[model samples]
Target chain A: MSFKAAVLVFPGSNCDRDCKVAVERSTGGHVDMVWHQDTALPSGLDLIVVPGGFSYGDYLRCGAMASLSPVMAEVVKAAERGVNVIGICNGFQILCESGLLPGALMRNNTLKYICKPIELKVENHNTAFTQGFTPGKSVWMTQGNADGNFVADADTLNAIEGNGQVVFRYVENPNGSANDIAGLMNERGNVLGMMPHPDRAFEAELGSDDGAILFRSLMERVAA
Target chain B: MKAKVHVFLKPGVLDVQGKAVEGALNGLSTVQGWANVSHVRVGKVLEFDVAATTAEEAKAQVKDMCDKLLANTVIESYTIEVA
Candidate 1:
């Protein structure tokens, strides 16, 4: 069985091509680059990636404008149907704004854009994306964003923690996110939103190959 | 009719921009009471014309806009004014 994936592209999305290449190389899957205004997605997608960048020029809020785009409506439906969905960086902000994920990505407490390689602990290995990594293993990836600080109310924090939906935690807590959460999954575990750029780190020469394991895990699941 | 929407970060949520502005303002003043600013919160205002005939209708419509897009209610709060 061949794995099928798609990378959604918004107007200001700079990482869409990188995400497509990473998924294609890592999973050996056919990837479709879908446009934001397109109302429909290619049929029979196994995974959907919301790539990072300042969508809609970060006009109102980081991801507020792009979340309401036509393609996101279909993306939300695909997520509801249990297709694996991953959002990275500004994509994480879009997912949160769209209500596909909980909480909000606030401005960095330091009020400066952060761009660096950071260590992330694999907090949950049971999910399809992180199954390739050992439990609690530390991995390296790049984080580049100004509004990557995550925040939610008390009840949401408690529920996500208790449900084991926290997928990854930052080792150094770069953006003042609550609980050091670098990544999160839905209660169903099929949707993930993270700030780090896994696609950017999938190759060894680029920095780290740890991210390939995530795509390989999905490929294995899709092949099965 | 016209609607004005004010969006603000919730009280408990940190307003980093507001804090920075407050700090800058305090640094510019040396008077005893001039630097007494506390609880500085930054917010945004969106003003737009609505096709509603009545103030109540315009408020309701603008409120829907806030809930759907203008404001992310998770860490932000919004107030609507119609004129």
Candidate 2:
């Protein structure tokens, strides 16, 4: 089965192209680059990838301005319709700011930008974004961001933890995020928001090809 | 009406920026009382004009804006002032 995915492109979304390439290479799917102001997403999208970057110049806060872009309205609608959605790095921040997912991505506790390959343990492999990997498998990916610390209220933390909403945890904490969360999925399991840069890890030359598993998993779901 | 909105991170959420600033202030031993500064939280102010005839109306409108966009209510609290 042929899968189709849309990659939303905000003003400062530098990683949009990388995400497109990754999806096309990993999933063998057609990828469309959607502008933030387009006001609509392509119909029948099997997946929506909100790629990493400092959208809107990281104005106000990372992803805050981009979250309000017209296209996000359509993205929210698609998510509600049960289409698979993945937000990476600044994209994750945008998802949280848009209220599609719980919590926020605050500044790193170290107050410095961190760019390095890191290991993440797949905490919940049942979701469409992680089903390609075995349960509790450890994967390598690149993380490059300044405001990647994930935060939430105590009640929300408890609820997400108890519900198995956390999909990935850092092997070694990098940004002081609550519960060392690197990736999280919504309760419905159709949407995922992660701080790491999976697009950057598309090949072993880039450090790891483990990120392909996510796109591959989505493709399998679409084919199924 | 002219409105000013102040956004601040809630208490309990670690303010790394504020802590860094406090550390710098404390390092300035050349200035008296700089060392005594504590809990030096940092926040942001946004000023804009709205089409409201009364201050109450402007305040309410700006407060709504704060709740919607100017602040992330999950981690930040906002105060609105209108003139």
Candidate 3:
């Protein structure tokens, strides 16, 4: 079975091409590069990836303007219908700003733009994104952002953790995120938002092949 | 009528920029002779004119804007004033 995927491209998104290439290579499937201005996504997509970059030049707030783009409304609708959606780095910020996921991405505790490969532990292996990995397995992926910190109220934090929604956790707590959360999934586990760039690590030539499992897992689940 | 909106990070939330500015102020205290500056918090203010007849209407409209877009209520709180 072949899977269909789409990579969203906003005005300032620099990682769209990376995501498209990774998805195509990993799934051996056709990938569409959807522009942010387009109001509708292609029909019958198994996965939608919101790649990283400074959308709208990080105006007002990171991902704040991009979240209101025309295509996001349709993306939100697709997510509600249980289509697998993954947001990486700035895309994660957009997801929170768009209300597809809860909480907010705040400025880094160090107030600096950090770019490096950090160790992440798979916290849950039940979701479509994490099912490829064994629970507690460690993977190193590139994380680059100024505002990568995740924050929420006590009640919301409790709810997400209690519900097993957190998918990845930073082993060394790089960005000072609440609970060292590097990634999380929605209540239904169809939508995931994470600060690390799995696309950047999808191949061995790219320095690591740890991220290929995420794409492969998506394909396997959708084909099932 | 004119409306003003103030957006600030909630208390107990770490304001990294605010802390940086506060550190700079402390550095200047010995050289510039400034005194009694203990802490600092940074926020944003947006002021605009609205086509409302009364201050109450303007405030209500601004509040709606804050809730919808101006502020991310998860990590932020906003106050609106109309004149």
Candidate 4:
């Protein structure tokens, strides 16, 4: 079975092409690059990727304006219909702003734009995105953001932890995220939002290939 | 009427930018002999004109905007003033 994917591209989204290339390389499938103003996504998509970068020039907030884009309304609907959604970097901020995922991405504790390769531990392997990794396995990927710190209220944080919604945790707590969380999934597990740029790590020449497992895992599920 | 909206990070939210500004101020105080400052927090203000006739109507409309967009509410609070 062939997997179909779409990568949403906002005006300032710099990672859309990389995400498209990564998806195509991992699944050997063509990826449609959808613009933010487009009213709808392609039909029968197995996956929707909200790629990284400073959307709308990071005005007001990193992803606040982008979350209100026309395409995001459809993305929210697709997520509700159980289509797998992966939000990376600024995409993670968009997910939170869209209310598809809990918590907010706050400015980094150090007040810096952190750009580095970081280690992430797979906290849950039951979801489509993490099935390729063993529980507690560490994967290396590039993460860069000024507002990658994940913040949620205490009760919400507790609930997320209890419900196994955490998909990844920073091995070294790079941005001072609450509970060291690097990635999260919605309650239904089909929607995921993460800070790391897995698309940037899909090839060995890019420094590591650990990120391919996430795409491969989704492809495996779609084929099954 | 014109409205001004003040948005602030809620207490206990760990304002990193505010902290950095406070640290810089403290360093300036020691070096340049300025007065000591404490509990320095940063917030944003947005001013815009609304078509509402009465001050109450303008405040209500601006409050709605704050609730819907200007503030996250989960981590930030906002105040609206109309004149």
CA lDDT of every candidate:
0.92, 0.91, 0.91, 0.92
Per-prediction TM-score, please?
A: 0.97, 0.98, 0.96, 0.97
- Kept native contacts, fraction for each prediction: 1.00, 0.81, 0.81, 0.44
DockQ of 2: 0.87
lDDT value, residue B38 of candidate 1: 71
Candidate 3 chain A: worst-modelled 10 consecutive residues by lDDT: A128-137
lDDT of each residue in A44-104, candidate 4, tens digit only: 9999999999999998887988998999999999999999999999999999999999999
Best by lDDT: 1
Question: lDDT of model 3 at residue A58?
Answer: 90
Q: For residues A179-206, could you state the per-residue lDDT of candidate 1 as single tens digits?
A: 9999998999889999999998899998
Please report how far candidate 3 places residue A29 from its true position, in Å: 1.4
Task: Indicate the residue-level lDDT of A111 in model 3.
Answer: 88
Segments in model 4 whose C-alpha atoms lie over 4 Å from true places: none
Tell me the tens digit of each residue's lDDT in model 2 across A1-224.
Answer: 58899999998889999999999999889999999999878889999999998899998888888888899999999999999999999999999999999999999999999999999999988888888987766899999999999999889999999999999999999999999999998999999999888898878888899999889998897788
Question: In angstroms, how far off is B14's CA in candidate 1?
Answer: 0.5
Poorest lDDT segment (10 consecutive residues) of candidate 4 chain A: A129-138
lDDT of 4 by residue, B1-83 (tens): 98889999999999998888888888897678545777788999999999987898888888888876788877898888888
